[model samples]
Structures are given as C-alpha cells and as structure tokens.
Target: MAAYESAIQSRVDCIEIDVSRSSDEVLFTLHGRQGFTTDIRKHKF
Candidate 1:
C-alpha cells in the first residue's frame, strides 16, 4: 500500500477508499470492491 500512501501524501484534495464489513463485523478496505471507483461501505446504524 506504499503507492496508495504516496499518492495520498501528494497533496491530494480528496481521496476515496472502499470499505466493507467482514464476517466478524469488522471494517476493511477493498480496492476491487467496485468497477473503477472504490466502494465505501459502512454499517447503517
């Protein structure tokens, strides 16, 4: 994830990440979750 970090550190105005709940209800970052753009998922509650 070095590249990702570098890009973010390059004075990016905005950044997006994909997150999903695991079997244990834990959140995770998934790059390939969506086609092209990242998918950020979170608990409704």
Candidate 2:
C-alpha cells in the first residue's frame, strides 16, 4: 500500500498499525483515508 511508503522510507524504530480482528479471524490494518474524516468501524473488515 502506498500509505506504507512514508513509514518505510522514514525507517521508524516502531510503527503502529491500528488493527481490529474480526470474528472470522481477519486482521484489518488501518490505512489513510480520502478527503473528510471516515469512520473505519462502519466496515466490519
């Protein structure tokens, strides 16, 4: 994902990714959004 480019380039010691594990055992890592603020919870991942 392009959003990861910044983190990769920066070489940060620790990068946190907001993750939500669904009941189906799927992990969702938070990525940037479009124009306005978005409620990522709206999607069950």
Candidate 3:
C-alpha cells in the first residue's frame, strides 16, 4: 500500500503489483516473483 502511495505522490502514470495466492488460498499483492523474501505458497495465510 505504501508503494502505491509513493507512486501516486510521485505522479506516476501507471503502477503494477504482482498478485499471488498462498497455500491457504489467501490472495495478496507483491512486487515480483524473483528475489522473493519467502515462498508464499508454502506459508498458510
């Protein structure tokens, strides 16, 4: 959410967010697949 705010403040024309589903079927947004801090699929949200 902070990233989106920052982009809005910077007057960005467009923004992108990566959405993924966890093992528990919880949906969330992230930046990218590469260099992920943790495996969302393995964690139960």
lDDT of 2 by residue, 1-45 (tens): 666778688886655577889999998988757566565547785
Clashing pairs in 3: none
lDDT of each: 0.65, 0.72, 0.77
Residue-level error in angstroms, candidate 1, position 12: 0.7
For model 2, name the residue pairs that clash: none
Please count the clashing residue pairs in each candidate, in the order shown.
Answer: 0, 0, 0
Models sorted by TM-score, best on top: 3, 1, 2
Which one wins on TM-score?
3
Reference-based TM-score of each model: 0.52, 0.45, 0.57
Which parts of model 2 are misplaced by more than 4 Å? 32-45
Ranking of all candidate structures by their lDDT, best first: 3, 2, 1
1-45 per-residue lDDT for model 1 (tens digits): 664686588976666666899999999885543465533444352
What is the model-wide C-alpha lDDT for candidate 1? 0.65
Better of 1 and 2 by lDDT: 2
Candidate 3 per-residue lDDT over residues 23-44, each given as its tens digit: 9999998764366566555988
Q: 16 in model 2: Cα distance from truth in Å?
A: 0.6
Prediction 2 global C-alpha lDDT = 0.72
